[model samples]
Target: MKRFALAAALVVLATVPLWVGSTYYVNIASQILFYAVFALAVNVLAGYAGLVSLGHAGLFGIAAYAAAKIMTSGHGHLAVAAGALAVTLAAAAVFAVLALRGTGLGFVMITVALGQIVWGVAYRWISLTNGDNGITISGRPSPFGLSLASPRGFYWATLAVFLLAVASMAVFVASPFGASVRGTRDQPRRMNALGYHVWMIRFLAFVLSGFWTGVAGLLYLYYNQFVSPQAVTLTASAEALLMVISGGTATLLGPITGAALVVVMKNVASAYIERWNFVLGAIFVAIVVFMPEGLVPGVARLVRRSPLR
Candidate 1:
């Protein structure tokens, strides 16, 4: 009953742009969806698998570049999207192979290095990425002869993908593979003693996280009609980490809520405050100091106490 109610609420929320009738609202909605997807991808690593990654922007940027390049070459077809997914997953696999060999700070360093390398490639590869100037695909491609350039059109498309991704992640978190990954996270030595390959599990989790991040990147490329090296910078990566942490690291829906709040707050704050980052930092500190488990968990506790659960 609760789940059904939640679904209905989401459907109503998804239709807000139609009622609001404003392009700005539509744009903000699109951004919320995009960042929600990005945050969810980060959740797979930090939430489910207990891995803190600061290089997701690398995967996100690479996938966006792949989509833009393919689209520019008159190949913005569904087939090209599939190819982009493949290439992004392949890059994830490579990163997994290299980073899974280490954990803790070593893993963090590896991801940081990977992000820097990707940023450099995107910036220096002028012919391919147009170097810093970025590439703008003329119009959004239709996956099945359906134009998605309009804000509302893109919003629905992105919402569908976001729903599907969330459902898939929910299923994955309840599956045996997810159980094993969690086990590896909690007690890797015990899992290894039981003959499980801990490193392999972590590597697979990394790849899955990358795949979802890639999908988000694809959506972002079409939504903004632009791709740039700055999108994959270390700051972007850190921002993702902040979202996951602030939202409640292990809660399934926490990152989405966190992303929405952060994005909306930043957008609102920048209009008035010159030092938005400082304000954001203060908010983060307060959240960390007051509600260490994140907003979602704290809200859940309050609801439980109110006889709502």
Candidate 2:
């Protein structure tokens, strides 16, 4: 029944552009789908692996810049992806080393510091990044031979990417290695005692998560056709963590749902209030204080106890 519900939800989301006549709504949906991918990437580390990162934006933003850089080189989509992958993997590997060396608050602090380093590079390196001016991707780059200049084409492309990312993550978490990683998360001491090589497991998880987020960054760059240092700052990193926590960690659908909810709320609230960031912060607080278990888990608990159940 839950599977059916999820399938139905997908159908609804996919057909949103069909029902909605406005291009604005279609663009909004595309943004949600991409952010969903980003959130899922964060979930891999924070949810299944019990690793909290505060510099996720650094990994993601690096890839976004890669996409932009690739575009200016007169390359095809595949070439752009390759460049993005190379840069992102290098960045991810470095971050994994730095992060895996620490644990708990120490790990989080390291991530924050590392993220700042990336941000600083983006800001100070005016020649490469264009500094505060941002990088412009004049026209949409074609994937294969298909041009996603239209809203519908881009929406479908984003959906396809989102589906692929979710499937990959689902398969990953159900594998034996994933179980071992989870073991490290749940019982690190026991796993270490059993020769689980906990540090390696954590490092692998971080790399995988960074790879996934790097893909999202590529999509994000294509969607916006711009990249700025501000996008990879501490605040952006915090947003990724919030998406995972608010949507329910350790669940495939949780991060995506959390992302959609956050995107929708931010868009809606920003129109009504001048202090929208305050509103966003308040919502985060409310989720942590009242819905610490996450909206999905909290709702599931109620469903299990209901008389109808």
Candidate 3:
């Protein structure tokens, strides 16, 4: 039943460009799709592996820089994809080793420091990053000879890639190694007793998450046709965390919901209100105080208890 519902939802999303036509909202939808993938990356660590990070934006920002730099340097879209993913995964490995050496607040502090380091490099290294000016790439991103020039074209492309990411995450979560990772998350001592390398599992999860995030960054680079230091700030990382926590942990679709919500607030709601940040803060507080499990899971729990099922 859940599978059927998910399929229906995807079908509806796949038809957005066709039904909604090319407009500002369609562009917003594209943002939602890519950002949803980004949120899913955060889900892999915080939701599945019991690891929280405050430096996620750093990883995200670095990947975007890598993609923009590679493409602007006359690399093909294929190279941009491969090189960016590789760079981010390598960075993720380093972050995991440094941040995963501890848990809770210690882990959080390490991640913040690591993320800040990345930001500092981007900010100070004007020769490489062009400093705050950013790298602006020209023309459409044509992968496999298909031009993602038009809004509809890009939207469909984003959907196809988003589905691929979702499929990959689904397979990973259902695999034996994924189960072991979850086991480690729940009971690391017991998992270690079972001869499973707990740290390795967590490391792999971290790297995997980074891979997805890099994919999102690549998409983001072309989506905006620009890259800037603003993309990798601590606030961006916080927004990713908010997406995960506000939507629900340990659930695939929760972060996507959170992403959609945040995008709507940032784009639509903020347009009408002068103090949109205040509104967002209130929502965050409500999520923390009331729906601690996230809006998706909290609503799901409510539905389950209301005799609607």
Candidate 4:
């Protein structure tokens, strides 16, 4: 019943642009989908694998730059997007090997350091990335001759990719490998004693998480038609973490909801307040203090206690 209701809700949401009929709203919705993908990728690390990453934006930005470069070089958007995912996954494998040396705060520091390094490269590599000037994609690409330039077309394309990503991750979370990853999270020492390669499992999760994040980056590049060093900054990394916390860590839909809420709030508040970061910070603090489990979990608890449920 719950699943059916959720499916219906999604169907309604997919048609929102038809009713809203605003290019601005379509762009906003596209951003929601993009960030939702990013949040879900982070959830794979922090929520399922119990690995906290403060440097995911590094992977995200790398994928964005790769996708934009590929598209600019005459590759189809879909091809570029796929290439971005592949490169990110490969990078993740390398990162996992290096990161396996430590855990907890040590792992966090490694990721943060890696993120800074990547940011520096993106900023300094002026010939390739164009530095702080950023890169402008010539135009949106067509997959098999289907144009994706219009805002409405881009929105639909984004929605389709987001759904595909969500479905793929959902299946991944249900597979045996997923169970092994969760086992590592729950009892790493025990899993190691049981002769399981716990490091390998976590490494695989990290790679897969990077792949999804890369896909999100591709969508972001297409949606915004631009890529810059700012996209990969520590601030972006922190925003991804906040999205996971605000949505509900372990729940599949939590990250999506959290991203939507945060994006919408930012848009609305930025219109009225000059200091939007202060408002965003206040909201984050409020959520942490009063709803630590996130909006989804809090609502679920409320539903459980309700007579209607």
Candidate 5:
């Protein structure tokens, strides 16, 4: 049954552009895909490792900015992307080392400070980032002779990447390293006593999280064709975090569901409602109040307890 449901969901996702009947909706779907990836990246640490970070947008923006800077300087699209990922991974390593100095709230605060530093640099680095004007890429990459110039093409490309990322994450979470990370999350002292090297497991998890976040950043840059300090803001990180929490941390589909809700509210709802932010906030509050475990797990729990079941 689960396999059938998964196959059905994939079919629906693959056919979204064909059925949506509008470029705007296709682009929105792309946004949801990349943002869902970002939220999943957050969930890697927050859910699995029990290390909640509030500065992942900084890592996300770093790759976007790196790609933009390289592409604008006449580098090849492939090279620019590779460079962006490399830079993001390096930054993530640094962040992990520093953030791991403290556990729980301390780690969160450290990430916040680190994120602010990135934001300040992006805002003030006018020479490279163009400051408030932002840097815009002139064209999209045509990988393997396939052009992503059209909206449908872009959406397909984004979907492909999203699937690869999801598969990789699924594998990661099922691996021994994933078990170690979860062990560390649930009982660091026990894991440490068992010779698991808790800190190392966490450090690696943080870096892995950064890697996926960087992938999302690269996709965001491609989708928007622009990079700016706005992408690195605290609000962006907070939003991604909210998506993770609202969707149910530790679950594969949770972040994606949350991302869909948040993206729809931000893009579709905002168009029809002037107080969309208020509405989104209210909905988030309701999710917290009613479905404290998150929409996915909460629904699953109810289903399990249902008389019909």
Candidate 6:
């Protein structure tokens, strides 16, 4: 039944553009998918490794900036993407090293500091990032003779990428290494006594998180055709973390569900309500109070206890 429901959900996601008449809604859906990828990336550390980073947006934005700079310089899409990933991975490695030097609140603080540096550079580096003006891509890529310029084309491409990311994450979280990560999270002393290098596990998971975040960054750049310091802000990182927590950390479906809720609130509800942030804050508080395990796990628990069930 779970598998059937997952398949049905995937089918509905793939066919969203066909049924959703408005281009606006399609774009919103696209945004949700990409952001879901971002949230999933964050979840790798926060959920499985028990490492919550407050600065991953720095890694995410760096990829976009790198890709934008290269693409704007007239490079091919593949080359530009490769450059972006390379830069992002290097930055991620550095971040992991520095942030892992501390644990608990210390780790969180180090990430915040590192993320601030990235945001500062992006905001102040006038020549490369164009400062407040932003860097605009020439256009969407045409890969293997298939153009992604059209709304439907881009939406389908996003779906493909999102699905691939999801499958990859599923494999990662189910593997032996993933189990080691969870072990380190729940019982670091025991794992260390068992000859497991807990720090290495956490480091690898952080880098892996960066890799997925980079992919989401590329998709974001393509979707907006622009990259700016705004994308690198701490707020972005916080929101992604919020999605993971709100949906249910350590669960595959949680980030996606949370992303859908957030994207809808930001895009749809804001249009009708002036004090959307207040409403969103209230919702977050309510989620924390009423569904402390997150919406996904909390609701599942409710369903399992329901008389109808």
> What is the full ranking by TM-score, best candidate first?
5, 6, 3, 2, 1, 4
List RMSD in Å for every model shown.
Answer: 1.7, 1.5, 1.4, 1.7, 0.8, 0.9
Q: Give the best candidate by lDDT.
A: 5
For residue 300, give model 3's deviation from the true position in Å. Answer: 0.7
Span of 10 residues, lowest total lDDT, candidate 5: 125-134
| Model 5 error, position 305 (Å) | 1.5
Per-residue error for 27 in candidate 2, Å, reads 0.8
**Cα-based RMSD of candidate 1:** 1.7
Query: Runs in model 3 with CA error above 4 Å?
Result: none
Tens-digit lDDT track of model 2 for 232-291: 989999988898999899888789888988888778667888888887778778877877
TM-scores vs. true structure, each candidate: 0.95, 0.95, 0.96, 0.94, 0.99, 0.98
- 7 in model 5: Cα distance from truth in Å? 1.2
Superior candidate under TM-score, 4 versus 5 = 5
Q: Write the per-residue lDDT of candidate 5 for residues 1-309, one digit (tens) a residue.
A: 989999999999999999999799999999999999999999999999999999999999999999999998899998998999999999999999999999999999999999999999999978877998899998999898879999999989999999998998899889999999999999999888998889899999999999999999999999999988999999999999999999999999899999999999999999999999999999989989989999999899889999996
Query: For candidate 6, lDDT tens digit of each residue in 46-108?
Result: 999999999989999999999999998999999988999999999999999999998899999
Candidate 4 local Cα displacement, residue 54, angstroms: 1.1
Backbone Cα, N, C clashes tallied per candidate: 0, 0, 0, 0, 0, 0
State candidate 6's TM-score.
0.98
Pull out the clashing pairs in model 6.
Answer: none
Quantify all predictions' global Cα lDDT against the true fold: 0.86, 0.89, 0.89, 0.86, 0.94, 0.93
Q: List, residue by residue over 184-244, the lDDT tens digit for candidate 1.
A: 8899999999999898899989999999999999888888889999999999999888888
Residue-level lDDT for 10 in candidate 2: 88
Cα lDDT tens digits for candidate 3, 1-309: 989998899899988987876478899999999999999999999899988888999998889999888888999877888999999999999999999899878888898999888888888899999988888988767677667998888888999999998888889889998798789889999999999998899999999999888888888888998888888888889999898889898788899899998999999999999899999889989987888889998888888889757
Candidate 5's displacement at residue 304, Å, is 1.4
